[model samples]
Target chain A: MLQGNCEILKREQLTETIFDVTVSAPEMAAKAKAGQFAQIRAEGFFLRRPISICEIDKAAGTLRFVFEVRGGGTEALSRLAVGEKMDLIAPLGNGFTLLPQGEVIVIGGGIGVPPMLGVALSYHGRAKAILGFRSRSAVILESDFIRTGQMPVVCTDDGSYGKAGVVTNALVEQIALRRPDLIAACGPEPMLRAVIEVARKEGIPCEVSLEQRMACGVGACLVCACRTVKNGEEHLRHVCKDGPVFPAEEVLL
Target chain B: MNRLAVTVAGVTFRNPVITASGACGFGREYNHFYPLSRLGGISVKGMTLRPQEGNLPPRVAETPAGMLNSVGLQNPGVDAFLQDELPWLEKQDTRIIANVAGHTVEDCEEIARRIEGSAVDMIELNISCPNVKQGGAAFGTSCMAAAEVTAAVRRYTTKPLMVKLSPNVTSITEIARAVEAAGADAVSLINTLLGMRIDLRTRRPILRNNVGGLSGPAVFPIAVRMVWQVANAVKIPVVGMGGIATWQDAVEMMMAGASAVQVGAAAFSDPMAPVKIVDGLAEYCADQGIESISEIVGSVHPWE
Candidate 1:
């Protein structure tokens, strides 16, 4: 990966907690794929922040990344202006697998919504979305789905908007209506667990993107690890290596 | 444009700037940032006979200009390294130096034998990991234990072997001499010093293990003095490292009697620091009209 400074082309508040940022990384954007990530820096920060590749326009040499201001690096990222330059290490980790056409359900919660947006744009055939947020203010990327003409089901904890429940409830309702052949989810640990449980019960194939505190962002440090059950034995796999995505059943909740 | 080439134990490195063990992690991560072929060499993470899960969380903590880590030598077993990591490493242009650690003599022997025919160019016996409770720092603290482990590995591999010494010991000279006399091709020192940080609010140690190895800019002077002492005591070549962040620090190590320097803790501050140090050293040499960097090695202490 080449580290370079990219001028921010645009920045918009998708929600109170999340921001959709587009930067100009010609080399990165030219090569970036749907499932990969970028290690971005807020200029003076010591550590680089990892953000998923939300979208890319190879010809225009612009990359879109969605991030929430949870930590210091992201908070710093939110303060940058349109023309400000940011150091970014892109296409750093493995991306999502492009599945063949099948009945698919893309599930996301809060910040996890961005990773699935690209997949939704690529895969054809019957595709539905189950989005979860704490309230209306936390929900994001709904318009992108609506623009794509895929009517999505949304869940908010306080009934502030959409269905008044967790995304899992929305998922169960959707599955009851018609089971999807494949289920994909990314969100907080609890929501992912619920989604996995629902998918397992319905006998639908499912995958979940995991998050762990990481240093090095590569497989070497052994810092960002998640326990997984493989061959009937549990072992630690680097979240940056074995996956940011893994079959839901294989991961140890 | 410069001769970054360095020779240790008759083996030539394309450049003197090898990626320090535990920092570069088999060289794959850095490969993402730059070309792996650009490095002089890469010391793989400390390995063992069997896979280790290593210490608990909060394994690392930041201190003033330095950081403490009790990673506890987390590594996949020798078998896993051989089956999975080795073949991948062999493809790289950089030299592979396996940093091995163990809880016992037999463990070291098994790991050495396992790596005998592998593509690795040398073995760095990591007897100096202070964070572990078992045989690591214990062997490094005592000359007798240092000699014993070195001899065990020497019996297995004819490849050049470097004994990594600990700084926690009272006399680093004694440990250096012991490893040299025990058939070590070279001796590298001083590993991160044993240290701990206090969390005032919790009124307890910040690290989950309560202690960790201190590395980075804070440990440079200590490492330089230890390298000087050890170099004087042993005939074997010395690879010195502590908080080497720039070319000047590297030059200090070389002048202090280090044949080559390893950049640790500094890598966390800047992933490309080693490359910059290598470039800076070349520029420094060129301006001084020095033909080879080896000319400046041990050039300090003219009065002595």
Candidate 2:
């Protein structure tokens, strides 16, 4: 990924809270993967904020990142004009592992949904996507998911639209009906933990992406390590190294 | 054509641009951006005898053109590195320098002894880490303590020793001489200067640690000055770091007496900085008609 400042081409609110931002990084788009992320430096900020790559069109030479305005950096990103340039360090961190021989079930909650969208688009297997939001205004990417032909199952807590329940309720029903061979999830910790527990009961292999407050996203600071039980051994693995994506059974949610 | 190389205290580096310790974290995450073997070498994060929790929130703050960090020597401890990181780092073609630190002289020695026969190319005694409550910054500020710890580790292994000195010391030359007399093979300076930032609204320190080590472009001039002073005083090869983000900065350090320059805070800005620096340095030397990069090492003494 190139380091110099590149201009922002577009910034639009997909949902009330979630915004889709596209930046000018031709090289990053060429090798961009669904699970990889970019560390973005807001013009006045010293440290860059890590945002997952939501979409990439290599031929078009464009990269897009979806972020929920959670903090100063992201809020700053949402306020920027189209012609403004931003310092972006892209295509970072390990991404989703492509598994063969199974229908893929993609699950997402809140802001964790964007990164998984890229994965669903890339998967060659039969893909079923389950999306969750607190209410209708918080929901995003429904049309995009449909455009991918996955026809994502939408769940809202308030019953403003779609299924009136947590995404897991929809997940359980999907598991019973479709019995997808593999599962992937990215969301709040509790939701991922629930998904992991569900995937385990069905004996289906699953992967979960995590988010931690990180400093040096490159693993130097040792700031964002998650404890995982692997091979019956408990270990602290760097989220940026071992993964932002880990097998559901292995991570200590 | 020769792919210019540097040999520091008998250890060979394919080039002189190395990823500084505490910046590149054993070369794993950065490997995603470029091949880990592309750099001259990588100095792993500082390892202590036991796992350290480091500092609290707001550990890093921006100061003018620099940044301050009180990360408090947070590491996975020596055992974890030996088990988890060392084997993987050893497999890479680049040189691995183990940066060792502790709360006491014996602790430093114990950790160094543990890595005696491992794949580590050298030992960089981190006497400059300012985040810990004990032994880290304390030892580097006093020549006696610096010598005590340097000699303690020197007795255990014959591996090359590179003592990292703090700029907070009253006389850098005295500390450099102390480590040199204690048998250090080389010296690296100047570790971040001790400084703090104020959060005007809260009317307190911006960093939770109250004080942090300052680094980045703001400290480049100071680091070059200290490297020049220490390099002249001890006769030991010096590795200079602090705000080195570009080829020009690397050249400035080498001319100021650094045999090799370390890239720290700059890595926070660009993960592939070390690789870009390695490539850029070569092009710069080629354009300058310099046969060997070593020719520019210490070339700034006359200017001073």
Candidate 3:
């Protein structure tokens, strides 16, 4: 990983509380992968905020990060203007490993949809995407997912948008039609649990990206540990180093 | 060039900035960011006699100026550390201070015996872990219990021993003096202070364990105070830690009577923090025209 000052190239409000920020970080963007995250240092905050890489533009030497203003740290991050420099450590954590030449179904919920955009763009196979949001106004990166994946499905809980159901409902329907070789997902715990349940029932291989409140983006601190079973023995794995991404069967979700 | 080297006990470190235990796991993870040889020493994560699963999730919470963690000594045990982790760590060009924790006196002695002739340069007895319910804070909070544990481990090994002290105690110097009397070669002070945070919405504790150890800039002043008091009370060298983030912090810690300082929570904000302090100390030495970095140790003079 490398630490450098990233110049904010652009910032846009994706929704009421969510934002899309593009920063100039050639070294980090060059090595960044789909599921890996960057730790952004905010002024007045003691710890760096860990945000996953939403998109990587290698040619432009920039990276896009989508985050919600959930706490003081992100609120500080959201206040940064264009051309401002922010300290960052990037290309952290083990990212998703894409399999070649297979039908893959990608499921995402809320803030989780942004990282899937990177995976969709990089997968060298038939990739389909299912995005779930709270309402029509909460939907983000729909057009980007459409441009990158084969078939993009959008769903909302309140029937305010396309399909008017959860992402897992769409996942189950897609699994019935053409059984994807792999299922990849990222989102809140409840949504990830639902997706994992469906994948297990269908006997489809799956991978998941986990979110944890972290201190060190590096593996040094055991702040982001999650339970996982390896070879029948349960162990606590560091989400920052061992993975932000792990096989569905391996993780005890 | 000024002599940055410091000889604590029998082993000599190239510098005086070691990565605090529990912050830097087994030296493998942070090695990707910078070479391990650049550090003065590395205190590997707290190890135990048996593999521990640690505390339940939501193990960390961010406070105003620091973070609290309740990772209850999650480790692969001594055998695994010797077999799987130590081989890789032995190759690194730095001193290895193995931080060991236990629930009983035998557990402490057994682990000390196991690592006696191993790759580790010294054994740092972790009697100060506040997250665990047993053995840790129990032994560290009292002078008698702290001395007993230190003496027990001293009997099993010939290697230099450093007892890591807790900041939660009423009299830190009392425990420091007790450990020194029990044949401890050195002492490291101010392990995270016991603290808790509550989630107002849920009306419940933030950590699953309800209480955790707090560390970062918030605890730096406490660490300095404790280190100064312990340094004055003990004859053995004292290693200071707690919220040391910058090169200036390191210098201040040395003046407070610490032979060396460990960088802990600061590494979370900047992966290069420890290395930056190491280089920054050299620059400070050169600019101030100090012949040796050791000259600043315990140099603070208060106007009485």
Q: Considering every candidate listed, which one attains the maximal TM-score? A: 3
Model 2: residue B255 alpha-carbon error in angstroms: 4.3
TM-score of each: 0.88, 0.77, 0.97
Task: Return the interface RMSD of the candidates, in order shown, one decimal each.
Answer: 2.8, 3.7, 1.1
**Sorted by TM-score, highest first, which candidate order results?**
3, 1, 2
DockQ result, candidate 1: 0.25
lDDT by residue (tens digit), candidate 1, A66-105: 9999856698999887999877767766666667766788
- Candidate number of the best lDDT: 3
Residues A13-120, model 3: lDDT tens digits: 999999999999998989999989998998998889989899989899999999999988999999998999878888898888788787889888999988988888
Residue runs of model 1 more than 4 Å from their true location after superposition: A13-17, A42-45, A124-126, B32-35, B55-70, B83-91, B117-119, B131-133, B169-174, B193-222, B264-271, B301-304
Q: 2 or 3: which has the higher TM-score? A: 3
Candidate 3 stretches with Cα past 4 Å from truth are A149-151
Model 1 chain B scores worst on lDDT over the 10 consecutive residues at B56-65
lDDT of 2 by residue, A52-148 (tens): 9898878777888899887666888888879888777777677887765668899989898898888888774378899999898888888888866
RMSD of 1: 3.3
Better of 1 and 2 by DockQ: 1
Evaluate candidate 1 and give its CAPRI docking class based on DockQ. acceptable
Please give the CA lDDT of all the candidate structures: 0.81, 0.84, 0.91
